[model samples]
Target: MFGMADMDPTGGLWNWAASSSLSGERVQGALAGALERTVISLDAEGMDGAVLCDVYHVSGDFPTLIDVYLAPETIAETTAASAVAVRLEVEIILPDDSLNPTRYVLADPAGGLRHVHVDEVETDDGPERRHVRPCTGDDPACAAAPEDKAA
Candidate 1:
């Protein structure tokens, strides 16, 4: 059962994690069921002619978007995006202990998000400092910068 907080405007986060390899079809199917009402399926063209069926969940009231991609070899394919629905994304452990759905995102006005990094530009009377923050909580692979590291 999902917690009320998990189903609310609270943006759900996920990272590239899994004790065992997960298939793209499995991820897409799971997300489609979890977000059946809001999900929009798409067959996006990828590089090298690799076609990917991506799933996106968008809330009509919020700019929040949940992107579920097919997991490739090694890395799980799925992430959630939100602009201003909440301050921080909450972590939820699914029944499958091997799976990790703790990916998150901060508000991005510039819309610079690549992989698991969010481009954060800060100008405080000095040289413009542009650093990358991880979209998720704490994955050594997708670790956030020291300044943005969670407590």
Candidate 2:
């Protein structure tokens, strides 16, 4: 369901998009992030729009360095850091028993991601987790599961 050539910006690298928000707050946040990171070659649309950047490989590869984060400071959160992996973050949000999965299309690195699919998953340790993987195309909300629909 994703079309390349139209999204891959770098021409050779993996294409990815951030997010567009209904509130437009995300648009401003993306712009601010680009500026803070000294991103000089941003798509024309991004200059005026906001992106819902959930995950980023901040270091591209850093140990304990958490290259990707859920709520990046650039987008405004309780903290400040670099953008990390967006893909992995989505998975952290997935449910363990729910077979329902979502799908997302990656935008060209040059154009940036427009929208994405993320699922929140619970963890045994402390909090919840989000993962950024391709969904199965049928996302049945956990509460909507037939077994629990009665509750």
Per-residue lDDT tens digits of candidate 1, residues 1-151?
1122123222333322211223445544444443332333355334442323442222121212233333223222222222111112222111112122222223232322233332222234211112334445456545544444348
Q: For model 2, what is the error of residue 50's alpha carbon versus the real structure, in angstroms, after optimal superposition?
A: 19
For model 2, how does the per-residue alpha-carbon lDDT over 1-151 read when each residue is reduced to its tens digit?
Answer: 1232223233222223232111223322443454354221232234322222322222111111111212222242201211222322211111122334433333332333322345434334222223454434245332333443456
Clashes of each: 5, 44
Off by over 4 Å in 2: 1-111, 122-131, 135-151
Error of 1 at 63 (Å): 30
TM-score of 2: 0.21
Q: List lDDT for all candidates, in order.
A: 0.29, 0.28
